[model samples]
Target: MADSTTPLLSRSNSEAEPETPRLAKQVPSLDDTIERCIGSFGWAQLLQAVLVSLAWVFDAQQTFISVFTDAEPTWHCSRPDDPSCNSSANLCLLPKDAWAWDKPSRTSVLSEWNLACAGPVIAGLPASSFFVGCLAGGLVLATLADSSLGRKNMLVLSCLMMSVTSTLTAFSPNIWVYAALRFVSGFGRATIGTCALVLSTEIVGKRWRGEVGVIGFLLFTFGFLSLPIMAYINRESSWRTLYLWTSVPAIFYCIIIHFAVRESPRWLLVKGRKDEAIETLRTITTRNQSSFRLSVSFSGISIVPETFDGNLYSAIKALVEKKWAFRRLMAVMTVGFGIGMVYYGMPLGVGNLAFNLYLSVTFNALSELPSSLLTFFLIGKLNRRSSLLVFTIISGICSIMCVVVGESRQVLQVAVELVSFFSACTAFSVLLIYTLELFPTCVRNSALSMVRQALVFGGVFSPVLVAAGRKDGFLSYGVFGLVIGCCGLFVVCLPETRGGTLCDTMDEQEYKEIIASNGGDDV
Candidate 1:
């Protein structure tokens, strides 16, 4: 083997590279090593992947819980016979005593904090603060999973922080305090989805790679679906009850992860922890497949960290310094920004639909069922770049159509909104999978986090848009359409990674690119 300066990659798992001694001939990739050691997906693999995917459920809970918690409860004439309160007039315009919220004032933050009439800025503050925290956390914590914390530790810490902050959020005395606490919660959970996706996929064989990502999507859908149910159950209770319900269970999940899951073997191998990687491989493999080894072939498997300086920012530096990685990053992020806008905005803006909030949200969540199932069955047949482009376009078209359909036909508007959200859901899932494939394992988590940050960055404005859209559909829905439509075009700039190999370092990726360009799988 050459010195550490030699840049090399293991051969494809399915075939050998044509000999080229100058390039250091064919060697088995860690992925190949993974298949040899853990040939089939076993019970241990299933449990760990399922456990990681489960985080998507809780993360979804946090993402959409505000839809119910901060909602402006329905108000009506204090007495049925009261003429002073007109159902036709704005609640803000009427005298305080003329009307009352249909539900108890404690049912939501809007009535409890008197934010219904306090204007959009104050009413939208908490949700906005949460997304801002997500953006900040994404930027700051993006590399930690790829660098020091490793996927398991990063996930546990993120879940713990998010849960504790959510628990404290239930006790906020005022709106300002509530908004700040929500910010902390958002910051804590920022890396939850990113770590889960990266860790889950890394632990499995390539045959299950795309499937694992979709499984997370399905769980995320389940999580989204659970919110409306829980909120409905606590409809008569304080908004605080919903927060407590979701947060407490998450704390228990964190403990289970600490005891049950192992760190990603690919991540361990990247950090040069050979023994631990071997142990992880052994644990996830079947009882019959006992001869797990990194092997002499793996002895030459050179993995490098993202950071050149060996500092906290090294991984990011690696991503940006490399022209190809930087280009891929910006393009995917643009698409994510659009998807995030429509994805988050539609749920929050359901209030503007002139339909029942609970039923409207239920319809929105149920849309995920078909979309996820389709993605799962067709994942192998789908082209990562094209799937993203088509879904984003479909989502944007339906979103704009929501405004054109108008509120006169309530069912139609709701249906169109559901379609838009469905496309966004599919695009969101495909984009996450695409991000996983585009970047290799070495800097995979950080790159995925940045893409999610782009998604969150788009979400930061959703509350404000939803707040304004309460009066006009265009501000939120219309803008959501235009942005996603334009951004989806960026997909053309990205390479199609439908059947690409998972390389360990940037150099390996460059080698893959050379092979791809030369019209051969190897040199």
Candidate 2:
């Protein structure tokens, strides 16, 4: 018969084991770890991620609506020699079907429509300005996520602010007011994504991080899927109706998140709220019926590192201080730029293609699901650098194929586009995961924001280039693809980070030693 004290002996032995010998206990098999961590909250987390992403999709839809909405009528004065073409009895001196109606009346109607909708057109300026606000928000507010503000608070605040701004945007009295509100909304939007990413990653164990991270992004794609439905419901209603409708759901989501999502234990521990962190862990472990205990004592959360030295100049100075950090930052920024070019550029470019816009957007959105799944699988099995490089190369090859097919062969062009879309989606999904893994917790948000800013910069330029290409042919898209492809070549230089622990503090010595011994790479 086994003694009751044997349980205590086994526990003590496990605790007393040397670090190297403890490897068996320390490192759980990937599948088992995933089964435990992901199994517990995977579906719920996925739902939450999708909800967050849907907000972005609605924002995208709102941004693009201007391109599709009917242009307002414009008024034009009829020449005395030309027959009066207005339909009103007072203005129409000639028959309604006369040639004058075909020319002058049509022109007047277009002119009148333009004049009527000029205010909304002017309002569209805010949509672009919002990106500028996003850049600022990312640089300033995002860093607060892992600090005193905490992830849950910041996320809730962001959601609330965005919802309020979106609702108010529908009620703006003028274009300037609408634009200002959009700027506010953009600021909120920028902070939420990175904050949520940090929060989600923090809640799970290291082994399941990749799956959870990729699923967060899948939620963003779900948002894209939902946008058209929301737009369709509010199609006949004013643009304001769309904003109002989107805002309503967010209010409820805010409540759900407040009640359901706990503060990240990692963040809590870092902030020295050990009790709260432990309780949070207990809640999770109890729900899953897992015998896991957080090794918080050895986890090292004594000091909270500052992300920036207070001002923009200091942040810049800090970012450039180390060679490795700077190179990694540049690499992520380049990848972000390439992803922005393809993600934003492709949807718009596809609209100009012969395919139906709605069908094409759906296809593009659907393509992301598989890419995300592929990323989840590959990220677990392959080195981060290898996965990124392979996907990018495949995307580039497909993009070049798009140019070869041209518009002459519709089926061929579409097939090529489908391939490009698949590869681009894969590259984009990996980029987010790669960016997250590249930095320590202190600078993670700021680093991600910088990369995101590069992406937005690319997005800003793509539209202008696409517009110009209308006269030159699809040369712009081909060139864009080539540029992205060339950028992918840089992937070879980045360190592979697979199976690596996320750096939670700025321990330069530890980082250097790890790099030196482990081939100087990131996973």
Candidate 3:
């Protein structure tokens, strides 16, 4: 029986009975809570994701447009007196051939400017210049997405700038002006994929991130597939018209992106805009057919707490400060450099084959579809390290075989080239997904931009090789095989990221230590 009026055993008895200590409520992290809110996806969320990914479709157009615009048009010598103008003769002589272009002179830069007789260095300048611009643009503009611009703003800005410059590029009266506009367009294009990738992934649930990322690749392939059709339709039209049509539609697309897409909630939280982040999350949950509420905002809810150090040097410094991060960057960039060279070089080399240029480009673009499907499958089921290693190795071996098979067997050469391109596409797709897992949200865009820069850097040298007028496998196939094979070795250094949660800061990304303590290896 309890004593109601006996003072509950008085002060002495109360002191004798120990009180139960209070356990603090564990606050959920921004990522964890956001993931819960997004939950299973609905149609609205999917539509939003797809609309943003349309940027990649336009990106593909800008990226490979040079293949058509800068093609070396077929020509025959008009000078009956020239002895070196035959098919078997060298076409590199500047003064020998008064050329008659098979197509309109304005259809390609080479014929428009009579660069067929020009040295390789002079002839390859515009293509090389475009990649150089891409490299520089990636390096300079990467942090804007991470720092102040945020993902949607940076993406919209890049799309508009790229569209305007590409449109203006069609009006260039001379080679110098043409090359300059390409450089600026490349600069604007540098962040388009980076922004689109980061923003789209951030808005989705963990289970759906890989799926959404693959959609970007698929859309890019669709855009690539469209190029040959457009080229065929305007086969008789000047290359300038191609630029106008592609770039004009892109401008209208950018306006839609600006109005429709929301900023990345992860990035908003990282930048300390709690209210905006909450609003963005609310929008995401609403679209996903869920509801979320936060009566009390967290006092320190940074998505990138480890990256709060304010400075222009923070992104690079973050990578350099950690030994593991630096190692990861080097390994990924090395692989990226190799894959990038082959990826760009393959399409350019397609023109050198015996097939029709339009058919060849279509085949090359089509190769991306199967690779995308394989990538989608592998990304979900396979470990990142092993998948990346296997794909790159296979790509390398197939590439080298193209050289061994020789172009004399045209069917075999083309078959080998397509296989190599297909494998390269798979390697590239996996590499991108793997990279997203390796880096934290704070510097993910910057880190990825560097990786892409390495790829563009590899492309910088491709135009020179392509311009050399050699179909021999050594420069294109052999070199690509060797580089990718060797770079694939770096895969040993990276930890597997399959089924692992993504981190928002550098410390969180290096989970190897925690895994080791738990009696498991990252492999």
Candidate 4:
């Protein structure tokens, strides 16, 4: 290889000077070489990616089940002896049976628990507590994935915990118990998506990262779409059935994950488990039918940590000490916070829209598919800055338009709301891909979790705003629009990452544009 001081000439100049030998190409780093050895596109890789993404479906199911289970069923005057039952005026004056539920009491939590007339303060408890759990869980357990636990172990544990807690929620005797159980379930839910994303992307070559990530998002949308159907099927049954259906499949999925999936090879190599990494790589190559030899390729490489200490404290220290990393983390998280507020707030706010809850939820869920597909397409073609800028601005404009259209024009309002949601969906997908590209494996899980936590942290305010009702657009649409638009402006600070390789260690990730300026030599 040429020395660092060598003056590199263009291909035409090099050819013209026949006596000058072309500088030997720089030997690829161990991580880059390993990625090439393991083929970029392969059947084995795709199968594993799809399997990991299946978890997102169940994660989505548990997330929005409350929309159906907590819904208020129809009610009417039922008691014949009550004076208001026969009269047409002043139902509150004769409170006896004047607002009796029309369906069986067990149909929904609001109906079964006699919370029909309960104010928003009490009614929104279950759903709101779940997100609170999400925030708490993500903050507390985020580092575990980056530390001793690794990606696979943390993912399996979280899936099992979420499933068990949610199942137990079905047997709750009171709203408090249900809310507590949901909180715990939310805690478990926090890591499932993050781990699935990290593990799936890590298992494959860099070219497939965006596609694999989008698979999880698509599965999530499918899961969201499933809720309304399940609720409709169990409409005559108890709300507990909804919990039962969603939780059971997740429990079974945990078993499959344990038996089928392997730890991330990139993580294994970086953690000094080269033997295990070689074995995993062999499996990948054999499945992909590649000709690369893991033993010969990594013979002289010393795969040691650059600055990371292989623990939570080290991960935090490394990220904070690096100027560029902390800035990237803060910038992306800021954008994530705004996107999260609208992303988490939208479905919950669907009831406030002047439309049927089922249809509105369905419309919003359906919007995710096309938006995700668009993201999948754009991720390959557009740079991170352009994609984030366009999608975030579009979402914000659509949200503002929703407020301008008003509720009186229900069709136009719904149309605009869907457009806002679709744009938000694309923005969120792009954000996830960008975050994955921005951070390295050492703190990838934690950094991604921080971005998610920012989103959930923003979400903590959403329920309160949503509880304010649909009297005006200020609470739901206007706030979502303004915050997302304002926060998205921070994206300009981030560098473009399209067509870049995934950085396995903090040292591998580029910072400060120094490399680009110095003829692409990594410092």
Candidate 5:
């Protein structure tokens, strides 16, 4: 019963109304428009996106490999004179009681390397450092993404840097050296994520932005799924081998991008490089075998407007000026922090439970695929706030159920854990999409980075909680779940954004106002 005329059910009135053409000319065909939008890359560009996401997946997997490595049986041992001993000590001098050696008679020997005790702590350093670097980068250079640096250059730089740093991490001789390389690696990693998003938005036609954004994230999840297979194959290999193998794909991707990708036509037009932008558009039309007719005018397209003085004070002022903006920021920050705690904390916490750690992690990872698929299908059909609320409630219920089906019942515990995995995955997938829609393009990167920073902050404290909880009880993880569920309450305050056109600038605030006046219904 949906109207065909209304493409996006969530669009505000002003947004639904087409803007007057700023340019004097217009493009002639859909083929031309598509071609001009993406340039010479064509279908191959999809591979480039996949490769970039794959590099990130590899980075995440390497960071987590230590967890699996640590759980190996080699890391455990039996005490001397214990009835559990399966063999006599090598130093035993008598045969009367070979299995039960006294302290003096027993010679404790390491059956395997105690890598598990150190691996998680050591491997976690790079992921932590990467997020820290992302926080700093978001605060410092996020604005530059749309202005001077341009999305293409920043993306290429990020990719190359990650490749080199990841490769070096494999060769590090000591833990300190590895950690330092990881910090640099993380800087590049953060740049890739931010820049790829910016680049995708700038290159695509305005009408296709939402679709492209969701697709990019879908590819990111694909990367996440692919990484575990790579790890499973190289499980017995040294950690160095894992890093080395992961970095190779990145190197290839960097080369492909260097040769194939083009600058954003919108970025060029905004920078007053009209001729270059036109030439790029022409190239796209030629490739697509269509005519370009759309007007490309700079008069209407504000070039990084000087709304306020460029300073920290000005940025703070901009965020606080509107009541709705402030509310949105606070809600995003709170939900972001909670989701982060659950997203990163749950897997680590589940692994610590008295179960097969690998199987548990695999189940958790597997559950995310369905969530990602569900988001792809439901995003255009459901309200953002409604979707978020539903998933958060489900995930919360599952968390509470985990407490009920504790170690006392292994089968029930496993089933509840599976439920917990899927619910958390659903919450995370929807959150990423919702956060992107909540902000305008002018400050999108900054807003997203801020939310991501909150998530990282949660991740920072999560390991400690997991470690402490294992030693004490499941109280730590339970607290984490309860906190996240409580945070879901904030989503009720957010406006629905499904099927809405992405807001490119704050000048579009009238659209938001219109949507707000409609009793939270889609325009």
Candidate 6:
């Protein structure tokens, strides 16, 4: 055997046995190891990737559920001669008997809790509470995937918590209880999207990263679209039915995750679990190949010899320590904040449109299809910086148009809003995938989580604006436009990582940056 003293990445081993002196046993980094294991994007990898990415479906459902549950049911004059329910009169000013909701009182939170006459702030509380929980959950659970729990375990925990909380939300007796449950539900799902995307991309080969990224967004779109359908089916029933519909499937999905999916091999290797990493890689990549062939493939492969027996927040500390990483994190989070504003705002605020609620939400959800398709097909060709810039700029302009159109031309306003939402959806898709490429594998989950939280932070303001905008358009739609357009400017500061390999360490990343800066030659 070659001397144990020799390093894994040495260029030469001239002092080795003359018989096999040139057969140098160079060690592979985690990226190199994954690339080799996943020689081609076979059905196995796709199945596993899809399984992991499916978490976004539930995440999207939980996110937009309020669109239906908290919706202010349409109302009409109770008596034909009653002028008290005229368009100009405030609903709060009218006698309770002057108007009646078109839908059953059990179909919505506003009617159930007698909150329809509550001011916008109080009416918007449940949605805002959910986002606040997401913020808290993100901060509290940020590093778990990167450290103690690992990606698969974190995903399981998040899905389970989200499902459990949502199931309980169905039984909420009052607005306060509903809002509190929504908060806890938000906390439970805070990491679902991040963990799903991070874990999916990390498990497969780099060649399929963009493809895998699109899968998650597509599934998320599916989830978003499903909400409107569930609401329509239960349109005559209680809103509580919607919660049971989404939560029960998600709880079962947790079981599927437990039995079918494998943890990310890159994550395993990073945590110093060599045998587990190798075994996972084998199971994912090798369907027909024998274990002996897999062993040959792993003959000279080795990890970076790193240990993570440190505290729970080691990855966060590593990110804080690296100046470039910190800068990258900040820039991306800023952009995510902008994207989040429109992404979460538009659907919740769809009620503001004079158009049909179910159709409007369906249109908004349908817009995600083209966005994902565009990103999926052009993922290889699109410039991250340019695409992000263009999408957000277009979204901002269209959002601003919602103000110009006013209520005079309702059709035109909805059209402009759709365009803005479409562009924002496109930006949102690109931003999450782009984030996966920005940081090293060790801190990727944590970094993505922080960025997602920033997006959630932007969402925290959306419900308040959407509620208030019932009177002033600018407070909701106009602000969504400005935040996305302005915050998106931060993308210019980050380097383009399209087509780049994943780095496992800060030093490796610095080396790659230096080589890139030097025109592909080592300095």
Which run of 10 residues does model 2 get worst, by summed lDDT?
101-110
Model 5 residue 402 lDDT score: 74
Identify the runs in model 4 with alpha carbons over 4 angstroms from their true place. Answer: 1-31, 79-94, 286-292, 510-513, 517-523
**Candidate 5 ranges beyond 4 A from true positions:** 1-56, 69-73, 76-131, 205-211, 266-304, 309-317, 320-323, 510-523
- What's the TM for model 5? 0.76
Candidate 2, which segments miss by more than 4 Å at Cα? 1-126, 287-318, 508-523
TM-score each candidate: 0.93, 0.76, 0.89, 0.90, 0.76, 0.92
Report clashes for each candidate as comma-separated counts: 1, 21, 0, 0, 8, 0
lDDT of 1 by residue, 1-523 (tens): 3332233353446765575744334333677667656764667888899998888888999988888999888888876676656654688888788888889999999999899989878988888889999988898899999889999999999999999999999999999999999999999999999999998889777777888788888998899889989999999999999999999999999999999899998888878888788777777776444433334435666564333665677888989998889999999999999999888888888877777888878888889878888888888789988888899999899899988999888788888889899999899989999999998777889999999999998888787787788778899899999999999999999998776668777767766767767797642
| lDDT tens per residue, model 6, 1-523 | 3343333344464555345212122224555545655664777788988999999999999999888888888887888776656764566788888888888899999998899878777888888888999999999999999888999999999999999999999999898899999999999999999999998888767777888889999999999999999899899999999999999999999999999999987787667776787778778774456656555555555444433445778877878777788989999999999989898889888888877889989999999999999999988788888899999999999999999899999889988999999999999889988989888878899999999998899888787788789889999999999999999898999988787778775666666676677688321
> What lDDT tens digits, residue by residue, belong to model 2 across residues 109-221?
12312233344335236546566666666666755665557777888887777777777877766556756887787777777767677677766656767787776667667
Mark the regions of model 3 whose C-alpha exceeds 4 Å error after superposition.
Answer: 1-28, 77-99, 286-304, 468-471, 510-523
Report the Cα lDDT for candidate 6: 0.84
Cα lDDT for residue 283, model 2? 60
lDDT of residue 262 for candidate 6: 93
Model 4, C-alpha of 134: deviation from truth (Å): 0.8
Model 4 lDDT tens row, 154-242: 99999999999999999999988988999999999899888999988887766777888898999999999999888888888999999
